[model samples]
Target chain A: MENQQQDAEPEDNSWLQSRVAELENNWRTAMADLDNLRKRTVRDTVQVRQQERKRAAKELLTVLDNLDLAIGHAEADPKTIVAGVEAVRAQADLAMSNLGFPRYGDDQGEPFDPQLHEAVSVVPAVGVKPGTVVQVVRPGYGDAENQLRPAAVVVAKAD
Target chain B: MENQQQDAEPEDNSWLQSRVAELENNWRTAMADLDNLRKRTVRDTVQVRQQERKRAAKELLTVLDNLDLAIGHAEADPKTIVAGVEAVRAQADLAMSNLGFPRYGDDQGEPFDPQLHEAVSVVPAVGVKPGTVVQVVRPGYGDAENQLRPAAVVVAKAD
Candidate 1:
């Protein structure tokens, strides 16, 4: 029994050493992966910022192009300035919508909610219901979850 | 001797078992870390996109506000439209510059370089050096590293 036990000890020791080595390799790999992820996160932060900026800037360039075109017409024909500007205004609305901020001026006659609309002045209006939005002084953009600004509005006065 | 060897074997086996358990725990934790990182990266992508869009939209809103103001004045006073439009132009230029895209129309009279300026046309002029920018047709924004567009220009005819 003693001879058998002694003989088996060498093999057991070697197997344990190999297992430890395998674990060490795995541990090292994990550590390296963590390090790599850390580095990548920093690089990704900068890359994402610049990429988003470029995208936004490109969108704005469309607005600038329309402005330039409108200005050009203003110089050539004074009569066309208002028409050109109206077209530009529509273009801006479209641009804002494309950028995830839909215009919200069409909410007139709707019940005013504190979350969506800011009542600048309560106004008495003939045959208008109280707490209803009579007019939107300035249109809001985006939604409740991702709001840019609430619509500045005038609500009907309560009798 | 057999009794001694048998007694040591159980201790060694228990120690090896505990060591293996520890290694398994560590490996599992690392795998969990990797998984968590992957999930975080996906969340970050969406967050970054929204954050950047909001920032860009805020900047654009200023330009929109100026446009709205100018248009409001247009109906009341047609004569002030051009002057109001010119101010809006300057405001647009300021807005673009605030977004890291300074207008570069001031590059006229300098030697034309293909990198900064795109020569749309070339013409001969007395006392003007070859490769000089005779006119800036349209201005550019930002610089080489962070450029929005190259300045469009008409250069002097190279002799």
Candidate 2:
């Protein structure tokens, strides 16, 4: 029994060496995959950005086309062209909303939040409370975390 | 010496077993990392798309604001307003180009390429070569692979 056990030791050691080699190979492959995936992530991010820009630009083209038509007709009737231009403006707003940046502003009497509002000027009014939004100079778009721009606002001054 | 070797056999086997367990744990961790990375990739892709859309939309808002201002000024002086609207039109074109979809078409008398130009109408002209673009009905944007729309063109008919 002792002689048989001694003879089996060499085979057992060889099996271990093979197992280690296999595990090392697998670990190397996994590391390589991770490296490759990291590289691919960067490339995909750039591609995705370009794709989205192109998509949003395409949406805006309809608005541009309408503007062009309105301008071309402006030579005929200025009154009708104004109405057409207003419609085109509304279409542009819709396009922006569709692109996921819904316009937000005109919180007339709401408490001002810095995250969404930038106080460009302060005004004192009898009916308005201090720190409240009295007027929006420019409307902002999107939510707090993903905001494109803060609403330029006039806040009620503390009396 | 033989007795010492026999005694060390159990220790060597235990060490090998521990090594195998450690390797298995490492492999599992790498797999978990890969799984987590995949989930992050999906989340990041969505984030990137939204970010790009927001950015592109923000760029468009200035153009829309300019259009609104031009329209508002239209009633005062219709002739000057036409020039103002023309400037706004140029601004819109720049915005599209900035967004990576520069306008194409208006290649009058140039050899018509089906990839960028859509033959909307055929015209027989005396000087224009056969299969050449005579007039552009509508302009296209972007390169072939990333085209937003094909330019609608009038191609000269084969004589």
Candidate 3:
């Protein structure tokens, strides 16, 4: 029995040592993977921002082109230039819409919500409910969840 | 001697087993950290794109506002309306510049380079060097390092 016990001890120690070596190797690989992932995230974030900027700017280029055409034709006819500019305005709106921030807040008599509307002024009005948006001084872009800016509005005052 | 060997073997086995357990724990923690970082990178990439879109769109809103103003006064003096439209054009250019893609390629006598200028057509010209840009049909935005689009140009033909 004494001989058998001593013989088993060496075998057990060798197995344990191998297991430690394997785990240590795995731990170092995991640490290296984590370090690499951190570096990649920083690079990807900047790339995403630059790509988005380029896309948005590309959309606006069409608007600039139309504006130039309007200006170039300005000396030809005053009425035609106005029509060209109106078309350019619509193009600008479409560009903003395509970029995921469609124009909003031109609606009159809509119930006021602080999240989507900024109360620029409170004015007394007949037949308009208190806390209702009587007028939109400036339109907003995007929805409540992803708002760029709240719509500047004039709210109806309480009687 | 057998009894002394038995005691030392158990001590060695216990230390090796403990080391294996510690390394396994550390390996698991590193793997978890790597997994979490990967998930965060995906979320942050989307957020960076959204933020950049918002920033670029915000700059364009000023252009739209000025366009609206120009249209509102279009019925005034025709010369004044032309001036208003010119101002709006300048604003649009500034907006593009602020977004890091300033306009280029309006130089009348610059040497044409394929990286910056796209030759729309080659035209024979008097006293102009071959491969020189005679006219810019359309302006480009951004530089060679970060080009949005190459400038469309009419190049002087080689004799």
Candidate 4:
């Protein structure tokens, strides 16, 4: 019985040693993976910003081209230039929409919400509720969650 | 001697078993960290893209506002509308440059490079090298590293 016990002890020790070595290797490998992932995240962030900028710039280029066309036509027909400029404005709005920041806050008679509208002036308005947006002085862009700027508005005065 | 060896064997075995347990715990902790980092990287990528889009969109809004101003002045003086539109075009160019994609490819006498200019038509030229850009049909945006589109050009043909 003593001989058997002595023989089994060395084998058990060797098995435990191998397990410790394996676990140590695994821990080191995981740490290295974490380091590499951190480096890649930095690089990917710059890449994503560059890509988004390029996309938005491309959309703006169409508006620029239309503006050039309007300027070119300005001498030939002054009346058409207004229509051409309006078309370009629409194109710019489309560009903003395509970039996920659609133009907003042109709605009249809507209830005023500070999250979406900035009241520039308050006046008593007929047939309009107090704290309602009577007019949008300047339209806003983007959604409620990621607004670039709140809509400039004239709100009805509280009577 | 056998009794002493028996007593020492159990002590060594227990120590080895403790070491294995500690190493296993460390490995699991490292794996969990890696998993958390991977999830964070995904969230960060979306955030970076949205932030970049918002920045570019904000720059474009100024150009849109200028367009609106130009349209509003169209009725006051027809000739002033041309100059107003031209200024707006310059503002759009500035917006693109601010976003890191400057306008390029309007050089008349520069040697044409396929990376920056696309040859729309080949024309014979006097006192100019072959493959030189005689005229830029349309300008390009962005740098060589991340071009939105190449400039459309009329290149001098080889004689």
Candidate 5:
């Protein structure tokens, strides 16, 4: 904030009376540029997002298509079905991670955190301390600053 | 530009002799705003691209992980092995498609289009024209516009 204010210094206002017109013109021009930039920024942001969405969508869609195909074939053979399914699942996860959604909240022994975990149920743990995550039903994603989603989990019941 | 020049006529600058000093201040303020917006736009563009790359990477990673898992389990059953591999492939395709890239350029009946189809081979055909696409060995993802990759194909030869 302070830096921005300092930059607003006009070079020569002491003789503004002589160049009142000029000063006004300069100021208005700058203002108009700023205004135009504001509008452009908004437009650009939308465009950028749309481009990203399309690109991301295409990549992820490919994964989904492959997964669907694999699922179809899985019914034919049961021996290595899980393995194939797991591979497809991995692809899906990778696609998501590429989108800046690195997976988190999968720590089995980590303590329960409300910020990272969504409590699905509270179960009595025989050995684990209360308030600890007893189970993670679904994993969460991202970090504190750019959170994608929370991990669904079960916390230990309090004594 | 023309409209802005006329705007000055609405206000009289004759009285600004004493307040002429403020002209410099106003100009400065406007200039500062303009500068700030320019910087913001540049920053925004970069951030957008970064986000896009991250998203793309994540989606692909998931598929890779699944593939890894599937291959490990392939030994369990020969019959189900292909199913697992196929599912992984489908998942990849879906992911890409979701990102705005779908499998394309595999049509054998469609005439050869330089814009969409690349001619890798030209076989002499009785009815087919020289430029007609006869076979597409490998499918291309996306179109030439924002396409991920061009389809490697074979086209009919002109007699």
Candidate 6:
């Protein structure tokens, strides 16, 4: 039994050793490829996301500017034009939201938050408490951290 | 002077030989890295773009569904309601465009090419020749071989 075992051991060892060495080489090559791919993916994702955001932002700017112009043409029909402008705003918001940036207007009556809100005006509030948001000057899109734009706001303060 | 030159020549040749070998190795490694990175970048760019487009498309689906609803509720002063609806439509178009799927809606009378236009219905026309696009039903997105959708259109037929 000892002779048989000894005879079998080296016979199996060489073949297995060669197989293991071949596998190790293949594995290392694959791992290097995977590592390179991962690094490249990170860089590409950043570039694509930045490009999408810029394109969306530029489009939004055009629509918003057009809405502003429509608002000026109020003499034709105030209610209709205003409704149209609101509709355009909603569409813009939907586009941003669709791009993983849901619309948010956290500036109305909420406590002052620098992270989410941008203070455009600070005025003493008669009814509202100090440091509370009095109004949202411009609505914002998306969440606090991933926000496309911060809400331009009016914060209340003590006289 | 001749002896000094002879000594310097050997030293210079040895240094140059070693430097050239080192530079060749470095250049080869860098070139391999660049090629690998380029290939990986292309794969990653496609993946990232598709991921972002899917995200945008998912978001747009809800907005598009909502716009369909809004279209039903569009009796709130025709001009205003229309303005709102148009804005929403424009926004959706812009969103698709931003995602590398630019809207394609060439007006009536353009010659129908099978590549860009998909004929849904055929109708007789007075002035328009057969195979001319009569109307576009749903706009196409993306361009040529990379098209996301083909234009659902009606082609004019011989009267």
Q: Clash number for model 6?
A: 1
Q: Quick one: ranking by DockQ, best first?
A: 3, 4, 2, 1, 5, 6
Candidates sorted on TM-score, descending: 3, 4, 1, 2, 5, 6
Q: Write candidate 4's Cα lDDT for B1-159 as tens digits.
A: 223334456666677677778889999999999999999999999999999998898889999999888877877776678789888999999998998878997678999887898889999877899878999998988777778888999989967
C-alpha lDDT values of all predictions: 0.80, 0.81, 0.85, 0.85, 0.67, 0.62
Indicate the DockQ of the complex predicted as candidate 2.
0.41
Across residues A54-94, which tens digit of lDDT does each residue of candidate 6 receive?
A: 45434444444455455556456655564655565566566
Candidate 3, chain A: TM-score? 0.88
TM-score-wise, the better of 5 and 6 is 5
Per-model root-mean-square deviation over C-alphas = 4.8, 5.0, 4.2, 4.3, 8.5, 13.2
Candidate 3 lDDT at B102 equals 92
Q: Report the CA-based lDDT of candidate 2 relative to the real structure.
A: 0.81
**Against the true two-chain complex, what DockQ does each candidate achieve?**
0.37, 0.41, 0.52, 0.52, 0.28, 0.06
List candidate 1 stretches off by more than 4 Å.
A1-10, A124-129, A157-159, B1-17
Q: Can you write out model 6's per-residue Cα lDDT over B41-143, one digit (the tens) per residue? A: 8876776765664455444544444454554465554554555555565666666666566778785789887888888999887678878898998667667
TM-score of each: 0.87, 0.84, 0.91, 0.90, 0.65, 0.51
| Candidate 1, CAPRI quality class derived from DockQ | acceptable
Worst 10 residues of 2 chain B by lDDT: B1-10
Tell me the tens digit of each residue's lDDT in model 4 across A31-129. 999999999999999899988988888888888988888878876876788889989999899999998878997667889988899889999878988
B47-152 per-residue lDDT for model 5 (tens digits): 8877776666656666666676566676565555665677667677776776677778657867777667767777777577666777887677777676655666
lDDT of 2 at A32: 81
Can you give the lDDT of residue B16 in candidate 1?
56
Fnat per candidate, as a fraction, reads 0.35, 0.53, 0.72, 0.75, 0.53, 0.08
* Model 5 residue A86 lDDT score: 65
lDDT of 1 at B25: 81
Candidate 6 lDDT for residue A61: 41
